[model samples]
Target: MEPVTTGLIYAAAMAAIATARPKWEPNRGNERQYVLRPADISPLSDFGIADAAVYPVSAAQFPSGVDRIVSELNGYGKFGGDWNGEGALAPTAESVKEAIDFIRAFPAGLALPSPTISVGGEIGFYWSSAAGYVDLQIESLGHASLYIRNRKTGQDRFDDDIDWRTVGRQWYQEKLSILQDPLQIAA
Candidate 1:
């Protein structure tokens, strides 16, 4: 076969493989359709809030009650108070609120311990929200890590590290529209 024909065949095959599988489409219309079990809510109240405002909780508090709550509610393991590294809980409403509170309380900034998987460096907490489940994107020395937590399971199955210089510049430009003062950048 000619080289051009072979290339055409390969491209066709790649497209077929890419579209053949059913995509995992999340239901963004109504969330109630996915019911939360009673067991899920029980732990939320039990989670101790003692030092939740503090990021990178001491080793003594590893797998804190808050972590347990996050795990039980989301059906996954959470790194509770740790933020620098792998986090114990997925970014849920509760978890995001906790993170926000921590950030607000420590405006000066804080060090988040490395989580489960090392990204070869550290990351600074920036913003978090629930996209599908919990979405946390942190900025580090010169890179950014995007973490998406599972909604029902509270698991971080999707974590990607990107070069800040390449992606962040574009992202910042787009995000600036949402801010009142685009010139004001957060650390």
Candidate 2:
């Protein structure tokens, strides 16, 4: 085959593969794919706050949650009126980046699930699990308000000002126990 023809065939094959499959991820269900990681970009001018209660299924997934939070950072100025709608706040670039850094800095020794990222008017960024959640409110560079809550036990605690790095995984280990499976709860 001519060189040009061979190149065309390879290009077509690659496109076909991309269309048929997304990258795979483990520790997640087989359905997992490279849907997250490297946040997807959209026109911030068009970005409007949705009913945050129903978080996107994509944002609920692994690293995808990280992507969603990062992408939404531009929403900071989207709300022309009071940015805080029913307690819905846009995330600041600093806080969003810090939240991500906190997740990355998490102790590898802990098997904590990836947190679903959410925003609040009062809070800057939030990382949550069925077990517990953390709130990060950005202050000056390298400083933030950190809050942790045990959902099931209703143990809520926070520091109005501190560094996220100061939090230890052992604290989360204790909070994780508070999360009981809903199925288990039903039984």
Candidate 3:
């Protein structure tokens, strides 16, 4: 299916889910979101589907930025040699999947990060705030680089060959806090 069609379908499904379940509580303390209670007869349970599971879909599960990332990834995935008209290489399927997985793991509450495709066929997620910015570039599935700068402290840090697989939500929560609240001190 075309990427736009797929995205539309996903959006329609999410809309249906939201309509069936029209309750959204604030994030409060924890980043997780609960459905409160499932509709006894929502559209999701139609078509004779028995025992339709209504799992809690956290913001992290399908962050608001996922659509842009997926769209860019699909477009980039179809690129061939010289896709950029400058002899740029196409991103491998592995790299695309890696990028998807990494973004899918983002914790809830952080603002939507802008996504971009590099001439090197790599995917990057960037976040910026009044105080600083965080750049996460995915070279492949388990390999990438992270650059963070704090304008308040004039400190910069970069790490190579990062294994995002093991980085938990707490780690993202801490780093993304810079974007969430620049005035707050890093704990």
What are the RMSD figures for all models against the true structure? 21.4, 16.9, 14.9
| Candidate 1 minimal-lDDT segment of 10 residues | 106-115
| Leading candidate by lDDT | 3
- Steric overlap count per candidate: 12, 2, 0
Give per-residue CA lDDT, model 3, range 112-176, as digits (tens).
57777788877788988878899999976577799999877878999888788888767777776
lDDT tens digits, residue span 1-187, model 1: 9999999999988784423112232223222232334443333356643322223333333443334333343432232344345553333444334333333332111222222222322223432323232233444433445554443345555446655445433453343223222234342
Q: Alpha carbon lDDT of residue 21, candidate 1?
A: 15
Which parts of model 2 have CA positions greater than 4 angstroms off?
A: 1-63, 77-81, 84-93, 103-123, 127-136, 148-155, 166-168, 175-177, 180-187
Which ranges in model 1 have alpha carbons more than 4 Å from their true place? Answer: 1-123, 126-141, 152-155, 168-187
- How does model 1 score by TM-score? 0.21
lDDT (10s digit) by residue, model 2, range 71-171: 45434434433454555555455555665566445455444343333445322555576866766565655566666788777878877766657767576
**Could you arrange the candidates by TM-score from highest to lowest?**
3, 2, 1
Q: Give the lDDT ranking, best first.
A: 3, 2, 1
